[model samples]
Target: SGVSCEFEENPCDSEPCLNGGECKGSQEFLHCECSTGYTGERCETKIDSCEPMPCYILGTESCEGESLSYHCKCLPGWEGNGIY
Candidate 1:
C-alpha cells in the first residue's frame, strides 16, 4: 500500500494578526503576539492604561490613557497637568 501526504494551510496566510501584531505558530497552532498597548486574540483591542487610574490625585485629576501613551490632567479649579 502507498502512503499519501496532505498539505496543511498556514493560519498566518490570512493575516490574522492586527495592529502590527506578529503572527506565530503553524497549522496545528496559531496565535498573535500583540504590540505595545494591544491585546485580544487578533490584537483587535487597544489596552486602556487609564482604566486603573494612574493619576496621583484622587477625583482631582483626569487620566487619559489612549493605547500606548498616558497623560494626567488636573480637573477644573485645580492647577498643574498632574503628570508628576
Candidate 2:
C-alpha cells in the first residue's frame, strides 16, 4: 500500500507582470493591478496621463488622469478655472 499528496503550484513564480505591478493569482492566469503612472493588461506600459497638455486656458490648467478619468490641475503660480 502507498499514499501520495498533491501540491498546488504558485502562479506568481514566473512573474508575468511588469513595471512593479502587483500580481494576483486567478484560476488560469494572473490579474495585474498597476501602480501609479502605469497601466495595461500586465502593467507593462507606462501611463501617459498628461497628454495633449490641456494648457489652452491661458496656459495654466494641466490635464492629468486619476485612475480612469482625467482632471485639470493648475500649474505652479496658476489658478483654477473654476471648471474642475
Candidate 3:
C-alpha cells in the first residue's frame, strides 16, 4: 500500500535551454539538446556551422564553432590568421 505518483514540475526549471541548451526531463517528454552554435525550438539560433563563413575578410575576422572544430579570432589591431 505505497503508491504515489505526482509529477508535474521540473521542466528544465523554466530555463527552456536557449543559446546554451541542456535540458532533459522524463515524465512525459521534454527535450533541448543544443549548444555549439545553437539551434531552434529552444536552443535559439546562432548557427555559423563554419560552412564557408570562417571569416576570411569580413569585419577583420570571426568564426566560432566548438563541436566539430573551428577557431579564428583577430579583429581589433589585427594579427595572425586575419591576414594583414
Candidate 4:
C-alpha cells in the first residue's frame, strides 16, 4: 500500500524563472514567458501591442490615426459620414 499526498503544490511558488517572473513548468522550469503587453503574476493582463493605423473612407482621401484605429477619408463629392 502507498500513501498519496492530498495537498497539491502551487506551481507559481517555485523560483521557476531567473528573471523573477511566474513560472509555468511542464518540461522546463519556465515554459511560457510573458510578453510586455501582458502583466500580473500569471500574465492575465491584456494590452494593445499594435500601433494605430490610418483609416481611409471608401470614397474619400482624408485619413487619420486613432488610439487603436484610424479615421476614413470621404469619397470625391458624395459624403454623409466619414465612416460607413
Best-matching candidate per TM-score: 1
lDDT of each: 0.81, 0.68, 0.69, 0.49
List model 1 lDDT by residue over 6-81, tens digit each: 6667889899999999999797899999998899999999899887777766545578777766788877776765
Tens-place lDDT digits, model 3, residues 11-78: 77878888778999765678999977678778887765566666666454676655456766768776
* Candidate 4 total steric clashes: 6
Question: lDDT: which is higher, 3 or 4?
Answer: 3
Question: Which segments of candidate 2 are over 4 A away from where they belong?
Answer: 1-5, 57-84
Clash pairs, candidate 3, are: none
The parts of candidate 4 lying over 4 Å away from their true place are 1-58
TM-score per prediction, in order, is 0.71, 0.52, 0.28, 0.26
By TM-score, how accurate is candidate 3?
0.28
What alpha-carbon RMSD in Å does predicted model 2 have with respect to the real structure?
A: 6.2
Q: If both were scored by TM-score, which would come out higher, candidate 1 or candidate 3?
A: 1
RMSD of 4: 9.3
Question: Considering TM-score, which of the candidate structures 1 and 4 is the better prediction for this target?
Answer: 1
User: Which residue pairs in model 4 clash with each other?
Assistant: 57-72, 57-73, 59-75, 60-73, 60-74, 60-75
